[model samples]
Target: MIELGKVEYYLLAINVIGAVVYLINMFLYRHTSNGQINVIVTITFLLGGSAGMLLMMLFFDRKAVKENMMSRVFVICIFIIQIIILLIYKGHHAEHVTFAFWKFFADHRMLLIYFGIMNLVTFIVFAIDKVNARAHRSRIRIVTLLGLLFAGGSIGGLISMYLFRHKTQKDYFTVGMPLIIIMQIVVIFYVMNAGW
Candidate 1:
């Protein structure tokens, strides 16, 4: 088991506080401007670490996640910085650090499973939407499709779009799907290469 030191513990505490603040703002305060909220959230994310902020963005404020590209990029950058710090610390304490790609896979098996399931679901939803479109039935909402794509289903979404010949004309899907895929790929590569 990895033991967290004082700095890590303090960072965790700050992250928890930041998450609480984010929740309160999301649930109780409706008067704040989007820009103001973004600034506050970004600052907290930077100071406290990004895992909590990312979870909040993914689960609580997906609309902002979808719309605020700059904030998303900033959060991702913060996450990268956190990873770099971890790598540097591990380098200093090399005896305690044993990193490999397979080790990462083993450690994060559940996350991989979640992604796999999400991708399958995204594909099915896209297929259903296409069938509905052909049958002149109620169509799936674009937001739902985009949400799935954003939530670790970009690969499935891209395949479905091409296989089903659906939503190909929409610039958002054509552009955004690939962009998300690229971003995901870059992050994965960075993690895989960080120490392994």
Candidate 2:
């Protein structure tokens, strides 16, 4: 049996609860505004990804993750699922929103700006960690990195990982970061599909 830490449990609780509420809002309000649906979907995937990450951490053995080809297939499947969800939402709501996805995104410029800022911050943190590592100074904690990733910085974190060669060796960074990206991608698509 896999044991989850207190923090992990708390995160899981938040994800599950938030996802439920978002789903409820999606269904209960049949005539929900585009903006409201966008926000709800954003929150849903953000929490859903966080929860998925926690579940993976609790149940996935590090050795298996590191060595197994099947695990890679699983990750790809998850990514595909996220993409399909986005496509479905977009297809269903396109008539309700902009004629094109690009215009839909333009309508939600503020969400993109927020994501840009978070990614920038995440990138800077990784850069700072790299510098500190080279200088032989105290390192930034993994928890902080993970927190930023959870808080909408997966893209930045992944870029930093490859760009700075930081945290690449760790199982969490390689595996968990992609999972975070999957969720973030869902959020991005949710905004793109936001009915307006």
Candidate 3:
């Protein structure tokens, strides 16, 4: 069994809780004003979240996603479909509310910027770690990597992990990283629906 630290467990729990809560809220009367729209978004999240988590888990189990060209193409296709569906849903809903996108962006731009910067930094850190490993040099601290990933650099962290072929075998990155991404997505979903 892969032993996860307390923090990893906490993050995983938060991810499941957040997604479930957000999904429940989406079905409530107050939140489900746009019935069809809400259904689309809800389904997308349910499917996307489940698929994403499954893929990550598969990677954690050492399935060698990188080794098989066909598997890589299939996974990429699924990921692209998920992104497309999410974008379409967001764009559709944006049209209903006047300047919703702008308002949301304006209010949460700082957070978005922070997430973006942190992800980039985290990706660079992971890439550097991979280089160091290859060169047999000193390495970045595990705590530092975990800290960055928890602080909203998850998407970047995962991207770097896969891109650099670094840390993919570790339970922390494979499992914990997906959990973080799910939590972040839930938070973003909540903030978008929350009227300013």
Candidate 4:
């Protein structure tokens, strides 16, 4: 049997509660434009990926169901922006959010790599899905994005999804996202026990 540590336990508890809160908020405010608010976007930014897209959608253009020249440009721009934001993470205003927490957390660079890989994978998978046209293009891009996220690299995927609106909501996300978080906990357990 797996035992949860205090930190992992608290993290898990917070995630579950956050999900519930997001669900409740979605049901309550689904129709409202509250998602446009930066604070609201930031709060769920990592979990939902809305923060990045909120601005684009408000300022640039909406994502259409079909692919076109403009859609290609949009995807390209989103990916580039994700890369920029991630590369600039060290200098972000959020750095001061918790100078102390940085000491305990794993290397931010490794985590950033994890995120970048997930989003890149999501992009490839999404492209392949568009070509297949078999029971596809149902927002599972978000799932692939978040699945990779759960697998470790969620921050990158999270940011990508927000900008791309890849896997906003879907059955895959419902299951895979939580599993990713759980896997991280398992890895943490192993690391702590393996004489790290």
lDDT of each structure?
Answer: 0.72, 0.63, 0.60, 0.43
Model 3 segments more than 4 A misplaced: 1-103, 194-196
Least accurate 10 contiguous residues by lDDT in model 1:
92-101
User: For each candidate, what TM-score against the reference?
Assistant: 0.49, 0.50, 0.46, 0.30
Candidate scoring better on lDDT of 2 and 3: 2
Model 2 CA deviation exceeding 4 Å by range: 1-101, 191-196
* TM-score winner, 1 or 4: 1
For candidate 2, lDDT tens digit of each residue in 46-120? 544433433443454233323332233334335455545645644644445333646745776877788889999
Q: Between prediction 1 and prediction 3, which has the larger TM-score?
A: 1
TM-score of decoy 4: 0.30
The residue-by-residue lDDT of candidate 3 on 26-63, one tens digit each, is: 34524455443434433543445434433443444233
Candidate closest to the true structure, highest lDDT:
1
After superposition of all CA atoms, the RMSD between model 3 and the true structure is: 16.1
Query: Ranking under lDDT, best-scoring first?
Result: 1, 2, 3, 4
RMSD of each: 7.3, 15.9, 16.1, 14.7
Q: Write the per-residue lDDT of candidate 1 for residues 55-158, one digit (tens) a residue.
A: 77688777743335445555655665665666566563333434365676678898788889989999999999999999999999887887788788988898
Candidate 1 to native Cα RMSD, angstroms = 7.3
Clashes of each: 0, 0, 0, 4
How many clashing residue pairs, candidate 1? Answer: 0
* TM-score-sorted candidate list, best first: 2, 1, 3, 4
